[model samples]
Target: MASAAFEDIAETFEFLDDWEDRYRHVIELGKAMPPLDPAFKVPATKVDGCASQVWLRPVVSGQGPAAVFDFQGDSDAMIVRGLIAILHALYAGLTLAQVGQVDAGFELGRLGLNEHLSAQRSNGVRAMVERIRSVAAV
Candidate 1:
């Protein structure tokens, strides 16, 4: 399930008539997100398969599957950073168990991202999702 924060973004997307406006909105969302600390942008946090340099620092609250999941993310490219912000909205604050249940493709499709995102960007998103799932699984 998508988080409320993600739902809000989807709602906004519904009102944006053109892809350009939607892109602007996405970029604005990225701009609004707090920057991840430079210290955490290390090899361990780096996500592969992304054209841009990207890092995700997972923050779990508590132990086991019941733990809440969150992350601080960053990207060298603006659009990629915006994508990370979108992913954060989709997954942040969810329980580790709940994270596994989210249908990311379906949720992202609701925003019409599937049609607009480049092939590489879509793959990068998948890679990031895989990274998130892997961390939660551990």
Candidate 2:
């Protein structure tokens, strides 16, 4: 498997050792992302369980078992937006089979997100993961 894009996040977290600094890093990641165009921000793409308004749109390509997908994600909250970027980093280049086989929540703990996020935020993240996985399952 290709190294996960968020592994850089884990390494960066390892050095900080403080949730506040870690959270600042998360916000920075969100700040660095290109804003999602308003046209793509529609009801059909909304993620249902996030506390913040969130959207997910995926473009799938290739054929048969070799199919791969790339996703676009956005959230109104800065932290949630950072989480969206993390999800994109982890998932964007993967084949559907690869996406289906991965454990998304485990990666959260690995990235220090599981420790820092509140229960609501964690659940929101899980919902986002499910949204991506549901798309891959199809």
Candidate 3:
């Protein structure tokens, strides 16, 4: 899944000459995300302060120290899904501490996403980071 996500991002970056194309590419990627089960849908899982309805579920494996997140959302919020994919790449297989150490906001800037995003979208990204931090703290 991580590899596929990376490949998607790489392909999008390579194919798109402008932000509009990139956004369309992102929307296509979002379409590829498997739908979340209805059972996991809950208010507690909903990310607060987002323009869209974002759901995040954490799975803590007994064999590992890290928590893996299963994310889903309503609305055709492509950039949000892409943002989630980025987070998955950074912290999916890491220990909780290691995941916590990652500077997601900085990484977003480094990846050139922060520069392209609107204030609301940027705030949503920050909210995601805060949510991840809270989950890691548990």
Candidate 4:
């Protein structure tokens, strides 16, 4: 699923010649993401440094070495939601170690999302990276 997601994004970027179309494709991807539960919406789970309200929750099952992350974002910003979906699809089911190994910057570049993102979105991405790293470190 992860590989397919990556391929789809790549294909979409390649097929679209305009940024507007690319942005629409990204929003479509975000729309495909499952809706997060309302109850999980809380200040504790809210991610800082984001231009919009973003929430991240980790689900650790038993004594598993990896943790699954479920994320939610509320914003009119399609790109941000798309970014979150990409992250979720790539790392949701992985272990902490695997999560830490992800080359986020490189992956974003590959998706052609890194350079175009706003500063606030970039900071949010960084914050997410830090949170993942912290969890992995433990």
lDDT of 4 by residue, 1-138 (tens): 244556667777888888778778778777877656778777776777787777766665435455554335443466667777777766666666666677777776776777777788889888876766576557
Between candidates 2 and 4, the one scoring higher on TM-score is: 2
TM-score for each predicted model, relative to the true structure:
0.98, 0.93, 0.76, 0.81
lDDT ranking from best candidate downward:
1, 2, 4, 3
Task: Give residue 92's error in model 4 in angstroms.
Answer: 2.1
- Please name the candidate that would achieve the greatest TM-score relative to the true structure: 1
Residue 115 alpha-carbon offset, candidate 4, angstroms: 1.7
> What does candidate 3's lDDT look like per residue over 1-138, in tens digits?
233455456665766778777776666666666656767668777788778767766665443445454334433376677666666555565566666677776655545677788888888878877887787767
Candidate with the greatest lDDT versus the true structure: 1
The Cα RMSD in angstroms, rounded to one decimal, for candidate 3 relative to the true structure is 3.3
- Tens digits of per-residue lDDT, candidate 1, 1-138, equal 889999999999999999999999988888888999999999999999998899999999999999999999999888888999999999999999999999999999999999999999999999999999999888
**TM-score ranking from best to worst?**
1, 2, 4, 3
Q: Higher-TM-score candidate among 3 and 4? A: 4
Candidate 1 wrong stretches, greater than 4 Å:
none
Judged by whole-model lDDT over C-alpha atoms, candidate 2 comes out at: 0.84
> How well does model 1 score by local distance difference test?
0.94
